[model samples]
Target chain A: MLKINDLHVKLEEEDKQILKGLTLEVPAGEVHAIMGPNGSGKSTLSYVLSGRDGYEVTGGDATLDGASLLEMEPEDRAAAGLFLAFQYPVEIPGVGNMTFLRTAVNAQRKARGEAELSSGDFLKIVRAKAAELQISPEMLKRPVNVGFSGGEKKRNEILQMAMLEPRMCILDETDSGLDVDAMRLVSDGVNALRSPDRSFLVITHYQRLLNHIQPDVVHIMSNGRIIKSGGPELALQVEENGYGDLLAEAG
Target chain B: MSEIAVKTKAQQTPQVTGAPKAVTALDDRLAAMSLPQGGFSAPARAEALSRLRVMGLPGPRDEYWRYTDPRLFNVPGPQPLPFDAKAPESPLFAQRDTLTLVFVDGAFDASSSDELALEGIEITTLAHADAAGDHWAAGLYGALEAAGQQPVKRPFAALNSAAAADGVLIRVTGTPSKPVHVLHRRAADAADAVWHHVIRLEEGAELTFLESGMVGARSNAVIEVDLAQGAKLHHITAKRAIDPKVGLSHLFARVAEGAVLKSFSLAVNGTHMRHEAVIDMAGDDAVAHVAAAVLGDGATGRFHHDDTVFITHGAERGESRQVFKKVLKNGATGVFQGKILVKQGAQKTDGYQISQALLLDEASQFLAKPELEIYADDVKCSHGSTTGAIDEHALFYLRSRGVPMDRAIVFLVLSFLADALEEVEDEGLRAEINERLEEWLTSHA
Candidate 1:
């Protein structure tokens, strides 16, 4: 489960408030989507929740499994079962994708006080998972996100999500640069990981992605707060009418 | 009467303005050094000393010294540093199938080294060869170094040739069964050492030469390599001395017809260091490559490293490449000066050079100069130089994946050094180098 209670944040370098008293809660085994226009503080919430720099949390708190996530570093957060699939996955020129993934898997394991996986064991699981995601061995051997297509990057991110298998996942505009076919492939990768004791806080600007990875609950966010909440029908309504009516009604 | 008059004039003009201040320093240096008493190397040593006396130490003013100041190396009787214990040699090579030659403070340790025996190879110490009188090494002694003096000045190389403390001579006539490992150890502090090594690969011969471990505070070395028709030489050097003193070195090579030469250097944690490489392709279809990967941190004290490389294409269809990369942090400094020249009639020549630095902090800095001159109209030559900070986005991306900040930085640093590491042809050697680089980065960063 993920919890955010009246979270307030601002830019550390400037006198600007990004998240103004935002509150939301996603219980276990639920997929929740947040629909918002640009500058409505959707990305800020994801960054703040993941403990990125340049954002100072002024008030309130965010928790995972009732444990405070604000005080932990980003790596520690991931070890505590939190994952963030970035909108733009980074391109590291020299670090191989397989090396990065193996390091991450072992790092999280070590942080969680578990035994490290042997090279043989790791190669087996990685190859199987990669096959399901349509990632070839060559793609896995190359540098992370270097020379990869948009869909390949998204699929790589999902592969990371699958490998880490964190309890709480945050997909920040994962559908932004993906096409319809690519979206389907990526959605299938995400849907396979959906299960009880797992939660997803999907942040998207439209309802198209929700059709592939159906959401159990939909929330409408304006400014920095969630002003509306409903079932999947809410996504359908937003897709048909846009955010203009909702923003005016919320105000 | 005329000789007496000349001696009187020389003594009287000691303070003349025409004689540069460097000459005075050179006199002090000569007084402190003596040539090998007698033997095959005596004439060459005397000749080198005469050349040193003529050129003298680098001038007091360093305006012509592109990026490094030779004043520290020119200091006479430099204060001794507290001698640190000799660091452990690379375990990767110790157990491997290689001929290990150990040197303590630049002096060959006979008892600890393996027997000088190998198929198709003749190995002997410079001292041993000198005592033998008119040996095979007589012809090669200081030959390439004297030839490398054109288009540049290396007064210290002349000094090394003249008063070398200790060195090894290797002559390869056929394929060697294993690599030759030059292992250096430091036993005293502020150890000022000069050494010269001459390696000759005969027609169709091949060799892999490895130099590793730390040296003394002030060490100067010169290696002369001669590759004949269709010969090949792979030379690799790795150093990690951090005494805040100095390390000066040069690798002068003459690559002949259809020969191939590849030299790679890895330098970490040193103060006031400069490594110069001069390679000449004298025969057609020869291939040459020189590369270095350096990491310097000023956190402990002053840290600086400079690499000066020059490659010349003098024959048809010759190819040459130079790659240098450095990682600097905590006020560390790095410099690279590289040049390539293609002679006339050297058509279809290929030359490439690239130098890059990744400054890990605002206090760190990198300076570079890259040049290419081609007299052949049909040659292909390109060069580039760049300096930049580490990618912040990439750092965060690695960290978010559950890798700690320290490990993530190491990964990125290795990534920055990847291009330079690629120059190592042997896969096992490259892997060992990567492991060594990772260990250094972990401890220093």
Candidate 2:
């Protein structure tokens, strides 16, 4: 389970507050979708929780499985089973996607005091997962996201998530640049990884993606705080009427 | 009596004006040392010595050496310390089937060297070749070096030409089945070693030349290569020396019509090291590529590395490229001076030059001088120079995936140099070089 209470965040370089007194919690075996408009601190929350640099947590606490996530390094946070599917996956030239994946998997394993996967075993699992996601062998061989299309990048992210199998997954705008088909494919990849031991925090703007990967709970975030929490029908309500009604209701 | 008076008068008149004390000392040392007998042409030696006297050892005031100080290399006296000759754990080119030629303290060790015979190639020591008789190598000993002296003056190369104790002469009549490996080891810790190698590839011939190991405590080396029409040469060098060594190596190559020349060098840690190369594409449709990957760690702010390269496209449709990459950390210093020149009549020429440095820490410094001189109106020439720290975003991305900080840094550094390493044509050699680089990264980390 992941929990956030009175979370306050600000940019380290400038005196600008992003997340102000936000509170949210996603228990085990549940999918939660946070719908927000522009500048709602949606991305900031994901970055801060993932232990990214340049973000100062001024107040409040966030934890994963009752352990604090703020004091750990980014890698340590990752080993603690927190995953962030970036909105714009980085393009790392000269590093093959397969090499990156294997290194990541082995590193996590080592950090968790588990045995590393052999190359042959890693290759087999990766190939099967890739085939399911429509990732070509060429894409897996090329530099990570160097020349991949937007859909391919999203699918690659999903592949990484599948490989890592983190307990708490945060998808930041995974549906932004994806088309309808890509959205379904990515949603299916995500749905396949769903289990009682894993939970997903799907951060998105529209309810279209929610239609594919149905969330058990829907939260409307505005002004750096979740103004309302409801069931899946809330997404339908917001999809029919925009945030204008939500803002009025929250006020 | 009259000749002695004239010489004294000339010395008093300061024929070498404004030369540093180190330069004068170097001249004195050269004058005192006994010159090798025979194989070398007398006139070439005299001319090179005269050039060295005029240019002097490059000082900090010299434009080309503004970033690097040549005083350390110009010190007099032989290296006082003896090098430990128990070969390194992983000697370069150890896994290859090569014609290995070992040199101990600048002297060729026949006992450790392979037989001086190979298919389609001829090899002989400079002393033996010169002692035997005048041959093809005599014509090329200092020919390309003297030609490279124009436009920019290399006093160290001139000194090497004038005072080299011993070297090798290799001639390739056809494609050689195996590569020629030159492994240098320093037996005398403070030995001041000088050597000049001559290589000539005949028309339609092909050869690969490999050089590795530490030259010596204080070493000056010059390698001259000539590729005839339709010939090809692949030259690779790895300078994997331990600390407290100063070395200066120069490579001068000329490519004839339809010939191809590819040279790559990897330099790791050293107190002070500089590798200078001058390549000329002389005939039409000739191709030349010169690349280097350098790594320097300041060991308390003493390590320094410089790569100076000048490539010329002289004939029409000629192509030339210069790629240099350096990774410096912990106050280490890296310097790169690279230029690509296209002649006026050389139409359809293509020239590319890129020099980049990744400074791991704020104390590390990188100085780059990238130049492109295009006289041909229709030619394409481009040059770029960049000095930066590691990409933080990329680092974060990697670290976020559970890779440790140190491993992430190593990965990024290797990725930065991967493009330069790709210039190596042989996959096996490339892997060897990669392993060397990885070793360096792990040790440094």
The docking category that best describes candidate 2 is: medium
Top model number, TM-score: 2
Question: What residue pairs clash in candidate 2, if any at all?
Answer: B39-B130, B79-B190, B80-B190, B81-B189, B81-B190, B82-B189, B83-B189
Task: Give each prediction's DockQ, rounded to 2 decimals.
Answer: 0.64, 0.74
Chain B, TM-score, each prediction? 0.93, 0.92
Q: After aligning candidate 2 to the native by TM-score, how far in Å is the CA of B397 from where it should be? A: 0.7
Q: Compared with the true structure, what per-residue lDDT tens digits does model 1 show for residues B14-99?
A: 23255666688788876766556688888888888888887778753433354577777878655576764554455435666889
Q: What's the CA error at residue B91 for candidate 1, in Å?
A: 5.7
Model 2 residue A46 CA deviation in Å = 1.2
Off by over 4 Å in 2: B1-23, B40-43, B78-82
